[model samples]
Target chain A: MSRQAFSWGRLPAPEQRLIKLASRFDALPTTTESLLPYGLGRSYGDSCLNSGGVLVGTRGLDRYIAFDRDSGVIEVEAGVSLGEIIELTLPQGWFPAALPGTRFVTVGGAIANDVHGKNHHRAGSFGHHLLGFELLRSDGQALHCSPTANAELFAATIGGLGLTGLIRRASLQLQRVPGPWISGSSERFGSLAEFFALSAEAETASAYTVAWIDSSATGANTGRGIFIRGNHAEGPNSTATPKGIRLPITPPQSLINPLTLAAFNALYYWRPAAVARDALWHWQPFFHPLDAVQEWNRIYGPRGFYQYQCVVPMQDAETVIGEMLQRIAESRLGSFLVVLKTFGSMAARGMMSFPRPGATLAIDFPNRGAPTLALLDALDALTMAADGAVYPAKDARMSPTAFRQYFPQWQAFARHVDPRFSSSFWRRVTETEVT
Target chain B: MRRILIMGATSAIAEATAREFAALGDALFLVGRNPDRLTAIADDLRLRGAAQAETWVMDARELNAYPALLDEATQRLGGLDTALIAHGTLTDQIAAQASSEMMLAEFQTNALSHMVLCTELGNRFEAQGHGCIAVISSVAGDRGRQSNYVYGSAKAAVTAFTSGLRQRLHPKGVHVLTIKPGFVDTPMTAAFKKGPLWATPATVAKAIVKAVQRGKPVLYTPWFWWPIMQIIKNVPEAIFRKLKL
Candidate 1:
């Protein structure tokens, strides 16, 4: 990951790897240069980025070194995508312990973000499953590190946003599922109060839970959503084998407007109840519904969209979540989908992981204009008031002050790994303090 | 995340490609001859959600200037994961035939520029031992036609260069992708008639993204053009000359 700097949006900063790699040279070049270290390119902001330098894109280095079928242990390159892993491992009755909303992310990215999934309450974040990794230091040395070996670097590298070093490969454990199917049920909630109650109650038993809110809904109906809870199908008798179906390509002009999404959400809110665990389902429908349609992200249009996700502690969950919904509705910057879930445990290993003892909410809104920024600012305030913080993976608008306020322990991690401070995300958020 | 760099950043197709990559929040280095356009496009890319976007303005035709320029771009973008050479010129074949100066200029811009860019990119990819290179060529390069062979010849050179480059680079962790666009509707091709097969800039961008993700070695823009050009390439010389294709 040797590069000089990275950029996210209009922001720019020098990468740590660039500084380290350059120092190794017998004579340092006068001109400033850098390289951007990239993980599956799934981030919503420039956190895992560097620009105006050499970019060490790790996507193609994907290779599955070994997979212990019996123990569900897997060793793979940092660039190995979750989709590739799932395609190869799921059929063998093994699955990642935790995953982000999408399956396109690389293992390096998943580790960087310390991503949590629907089963976060049950299995925790990716850091929990991560056992070790091959780290390519700024000086070009490949050293293997684990909990017992270079433990601080391992902890810092997890959720470190590729600032510590280049993650060459990772070894982790996979979970064995009873079947590819999930026995899921949906219940409608009319308000934030109902939503929180239902979510908390469901967390006690369900292995997976998520809520879909209509960001456009206002007043009494604001935050109204369909709460979904699911557990792995008990056995083969619980469901049938799934079939393969793919939408080859996305139409060049599929507009996902308020009207279109409204109709879709209405059906989504009602349709889940229609199939009340009558039969077995395919994993694609359950896990990667968006994958069915290739390039589905294009539906956001040329301007694209930003996904804002924040986790609010239980103490301030109601007011924070309610105020966020109210502000979003008032802003009129509508979102196609708003998901809510509760995270039960924390992966202490990751330096900057997002999850905590709180209810996490993710809302995707098309970039309309200034109102979008304004709304996000307001949401940030509300989340902060609730003792919450935003997800770094899906964030593009968070301020350094906000980041500092949210992650007070950042200084410790920053000093430990990249004391000189080399990372686009670090440069942008803490411009004055980083380098 | 994918780290993508576009050497010809200001082109319509490159702008669209930048937007697509930006949507994925990829870090990008947009290089071009015009600083204003590069900065403007980079700003626009950021607004569209690029995690990072930077601009570099330099004459791509100056092969000697590439190593430094590339060094700057790579430093700016972090490291080069993939570099897409979207730079090329569209010259009038009749004008080229009328003047040797016109032919030389066209060849420099269309073929030589890409050659230099590809060589530098290929070396970096090889150094890393893993990366992808996507270059935008023309379907006309598959076989020369009487109407635009001058431009076709340059593209043909680029096409042949890319094929050999791919063979050498692919073995060393670099995946070379050649995009042969038949008739893309852009400022360069606006004078031509628009037809079903003539793709929009956005379509070309979409196809390029798909090809990179799929790791396809070579692809015709619309996919159908692959078969169309196959038949065209195999056509008898006598019959091909009589046809106005």
Candidate 2:
């Protein structure tokens, strides 16, 4: 069977192999061969892909074991999706402390990536809310790991990219909210300095804050975009469900060229809604706007797209980001969707977690073959020079040297990875053959 | 809010459909083979706005337990306004061809067990005289191909049985819907290569829910499957026999 990432890139036709469903943790297969725990396949890059190995699809194991309404604590199978969690918890005035851009991502994927959301400035990454989890190993041993119990393994497993073992079930602390609606405001910022100023102000006022930069802009208008800041609203949620629009097929590659992107970026920046100062928003629209369009990635065409995300230290954030944006503008290859955000002082629990007290930028580039790869390489160099790290969850082509520079603790984390488990990303970054 | 009973509630399609009902604030009585899984699903439903989400554990293959299970579901949910049966195994076609035991086991799990539960639920729904009973049949049942005739034949039995049940229950205002889904991308079909033809479990669940509400006797999920299966069902046996599909 062929498995592809959400980006629709790296479609490897792996030989179909079955890993029998384990109704209980005790029934998990005991095997020495490399295995990857597969969930909803929502990962954009190679982290979820195992080229020559077995993938144990975990969606069947989805179940919620326990939930305490009073304390807002919940235990769920790793296969459960954030969408399912939201549907199950939102009515109870609780939500996942940390969420990704999409609700389709599974709990296991969130932990493996240590995903951060709009609230990273306040809530940190997904690993911060993880209470404990049960890891089933190839030797048929189910180890319980938490901050206090088997803490090392717990740290390694959080952003271990499913290389540690199969996460069967996990307990997490959810954040209690007033309701599902977000009382928010959006303001247009003219330059990078203004963005920094607005983001600083948002930190104290809003629980969730993020900005969308028009990467295509340059010179005096560089970094011109909309900054959205929000907090949970105290009222009954508006019951209107947004009708999803689907991209029926992959369009021609020429459909999303430089001209189209520039126009789209300009139109989006000057939109009336983007200029609006305040409005009430639903959780879905505020947290996962792109989700309203099903298979929206198809707009990038069949070759798919690449998301380049990197974080640099707070001190060097402005200069590094400005240089990167200048390069993108000179190349005339800027993407339509560009996001910039700042991380809070709260530390991430995962050893390899991507979030830190710094500024992060993410941009999506349609796969235009060599030019796209070359531009990304230049961006990587800039990030590395600023003592920054690229997010592995969104990477497909980071060189081993760059990976080592980005995550210096890889060698130590390698010891904790299960010998019986490996992934394409792990192999690519480590340059090691599957055992 | 409706009172609902979902047998095999842990199955992907059933779980998704249960979420739809839960969102509507329905009372649910969930029954599944795994007690832990059932309890977990119940907990999720409770949090999703289900007025009351209760669970019971019973292996569907145990036909003798069908009556008691139905009784418990009815008693727990107070009354059943809707019930869904969404469980079946996709057997290894090559293995089933070589072993009679494999074929019989597949039949027992897919057709016989469902028939037993359906019969028990039919009687109760008939007495109540106002409810919906939706069962998931497969597009493979439209016409049996050599690739999966063992699984297809069992689904064929279900389609035929549900057709008769629909006729019998229609006059009494009890609805029976047979859901025929084509190439759903579920854990059951995870091993198969998915393509444009594949649909998500949530998509199929939405169709099933809509079909039940509209009192449709038969439905092809995703709607396109109706025409696709029509073409497949019309294929000459001479041509179909030579094709590997």
Candidate 3:
């Protein structure tokens, strides 16, 4: 099987050697060389890729172990996806405590990435909700890790990018929701300052908040976009399931060039009905709009695109984000979707988790070869200067220096990484051989 | 809601189909060789809105276990309205050619075991005078290829057996469906390079659900496989023998 990243970015193809983990615990302990747990390949970067190494495919290990309806606690095997969880628990008045941009990601992947969402300002990242998990080491030892048990290992493995060991099963504290419907409000902001002000107010008023900036805008128009905040609505609303529309095939390279992106962005930002709209949305459309269009990434054309997501401290957010947007506009290689959000003051639980009390911005740029690389490198420099870090889950080509700089605890985290397990992203950023 | 029984519930195709049934609030008795996987599938089904999801673990290759398993599923599900047999293995043709035991094991698992289960289920369904029996055959069985003839031959036997079973059950008002799916992107075929002709397990699952509901006698999932298989089946052996598939 040809395994590709979600971004569809070009990278060194990994040797596709996969061992399907059985659902039975007694059936496991299958010995393999340099094994990495491969979930649903939803990560945008090569964090899930192990070039020339073995991958223990966890998709087969999907099983629900236990659920407490009263307490809203559920225990499930690592392979179960967030979408599966929502499908099962939403009707019971429970939902995942935290969710990423897409529900297609697996439990193990969510933990490994410590993924955040629109509600990061309220609930924090995925790791914050994990009550406990079982980590099966390469040496055949199964360690029960949590805040109180194997605390250091728990911290290391949370955002360890699957390098610590194979995550077998995890127990999570599911959030209680009134219903699956979201009462959402969207406000068009004139500039970056306006977005910050809206985000501050929404952070307290709503459970979820995020902004979509038109990255193509330059000078005074830079950071001009829409801010959306939403809260779970009470009672039953119409259960309008999203009808998936798939991109049948990859289009030609000209499909997502600057001209098309600019027009789309402008039309999206200035749409009359979207200027200050308040609407009721099903959870699917509100949280996973991209999922409604299956294989939407193919719209970026055959070459694929790269997602650059970074977070800078609240103090330097304005200058750093402003400079980053200015650089992107100058390059004329603007993204189709550029999101900006604010993280709360909640301390990160995972040692290497990306979320911090700061401003995070994410943008997608079509892979335009050397020029694109150069532009991204410039943005990385800005992020580094702001004393911020790029998310490893979304990075394909961050330099070793930048990685070391961003994650100052790399050496400490590296110590906990299973010697037998490694990934393309780990290899690239660490510049080390698995042996 | 329909009461359904899925054999080899852990198989990717069967799992996907079970999910669809669960989403429709069907009652299910899932049977699979792996206890952990069976439990998992059942739990997922229950969560997905299945009225009741029960599981039984027994190796389908052990033909003697068929009777008891069927009894348990029927008893648990309160009488099955539909049953799907989707247990099979794709063996290495080259290895099987060198080893008679390998070929026999493949044949037993893919064809003989299924035939046994179908016979047991067919009798009950016929006696009940209403039900559906759906078995997953393969497009590979349409014609033998030198590369995987051992697996192909087993599927061929299954296709022929189901046809006879369908004929026998029709008068009794028991519907029998033979599903000849083209190359599906399942774990069984994960090693093979995929192309446009390939379909996902979900796609095949949808076809299976539709076919069972409509009481279709034969189905080629993705529909396009009907013509593609026809073209291959019609090839002259004289020329086909010279070319490698």
Q: Measured against the native two-chain assembly using Cα atoms, what DockQ does each of the candidate structures obtain, in the order listed?
A: 0.02, 0.37, 0.42
RMSD in Å for model 3 = 3.1
lDDT of 2 by residue, A66-112 (tens): 77889999998898898888877788889999998889888988898
- lDDT (tens digit, per residue) of candidate 1 on B1-96: 777888888887888888789878899988888775566566646645688988888777887998998788778877779888888778888899
Q: What share of the true interface contacts does each candidate keep?
A: 0.00, 0.43, 0.48
Ranking by DockQ: 3, 2, 1
At residue A420, what lDDT does model 1 achieve?
24
Writing each residue's lDDT as its tens digit, candidate 3 over A161-262 gives 999998989999999999888897887998888988888887888999988999888889988998888999884555557788887877876377778878
Using lDDT as the measure, the top candidate is: 3
- A208 Cα displacement, candidate 2 (Å): 2.7
lDDT tens per residue, model 1, A70-111: 999987767778877876677678888887777878898888
Candidate 2, pairs of clashing residues: none
Ranked candidates (TM-score, high to low): 3, 2, 1
- TM-score of model number 2, chain B: 0.97
TM-score per candidate, chains pooled: 0.61, 0.87, 0.91
Quote model 3's TM-score: 0.91
Q: Write the per-residue lDDT of candidate 2 for residues B124-157, one digit (tens) a residue.
A: 8899888888998899988888899999999999
Winner by DockQ: 3
